[model samples]
Target: MLIAFNKPYGVLCQFTDESTGPARPTLATFIDVPGVYPAGRLDLDSEGLLLLTDDGRLQARIADPRYKAPKTYLVQVEGEPDEDALAALRRGVRLKDGMTLPAQVERIEAPDLWPRNPPVRFRKSVPDCWLKLILREGRNRQVRRMTAAVGHPTLRLVRWRIGDWTLEGIAPGEWREVPV
Candidate 1:
């Protein structure tokens, strides 16, 4: 079984919370599918498409970086990026982990997206722009860090697609099982 979950911001990716702090929302609250586990993770601060599967081989194919599955994100950054910044992203930016693989990036119009609870802050002086970034490698906070390194800190981040799956009709906090 394959499941695509539109994970909401501030929600934990895992089914259970291991932290000792006050409880936060988790996948268990939304997903009731037995034996299915998240194929990959989206940070607590980020939102959008998350894939889960009950099949181990399918899970590995989705999560493993070796598969080079394209993951697309719609990023709202603080400043407008010129061609130079876009080129830098395309060429690959050096992160603490190492140089990132060249990414597919382009400036795009703001996506029609669901409203985020505790919405991203608004700024009058600092103009923001939207970017569509596609990456094959899954690194922790890589997209956020990459944008920040290029002088445009991300204001809001949404993973729009993973592999061939997308958040097309799914609303935040909604999950739908799809045929594998």
Candidate 2:
């Protein structure tokens, strides 16, 4: 079975948290279906579409970077992005790890999204803007790092779409079965 889950902020992508200290919220808290596992990770601080599946082949197809499934994110950055910054992102930016694949990025109006539980900090002095970024590869904290490299640190990051699946009707902490 394939599932689309809207992961909330501060929740681990995994079913369990093995680290010491007070247990952080995990996928198991919201997902009760047996045998289903997350296809890819959405960082604890980031929010949005997460796919899960019980089938190993389907899971690998969705999660593996080799398949190059496009993932889209709505990012709120600290400063307004100029054409140079946007162009850089479009051409692919050099990250500490390596050069990223070219991404489709554009300035966009703030998207209508659910309010974050704790909320993003309001900085009166620095201006902020929204961006729509589509990437073919999934790298750890890539969105955050990409924006930061372009002089616009990300204030908030939300994965809006993954391949053909989206968080359209799936509210935070909610999941629904989808056709394979």
lDDT of 1 at 90: 98
| Cα lDDT listed for each candidate | 0.95, 0.95
Per-residue C-alpha lDDT of model 2 across residues 1-180, encoded as one tens digit per residue: 999999999999999999898999999999999999999999999999999999999999999999999999999999999999999999999999999999999999999999998899998999999999999998899999999999999989999998999889889999999888
State the displacement of the C-alpha of residue 35, model 2, in Å, after optimal TM-score superposition: 0.3
- Give the alpha carbon lDDT tens digit for every residue of 1-180 in model 1: 999999999999999999999999999999998899999999999999999999999999999999999999999999999999999999999999999999999999988999989899998998999999999999999999999988999989999998899889999999998766
Q: What is the TM-score of each candidate against the true structure?
A: 0.98, 0.98
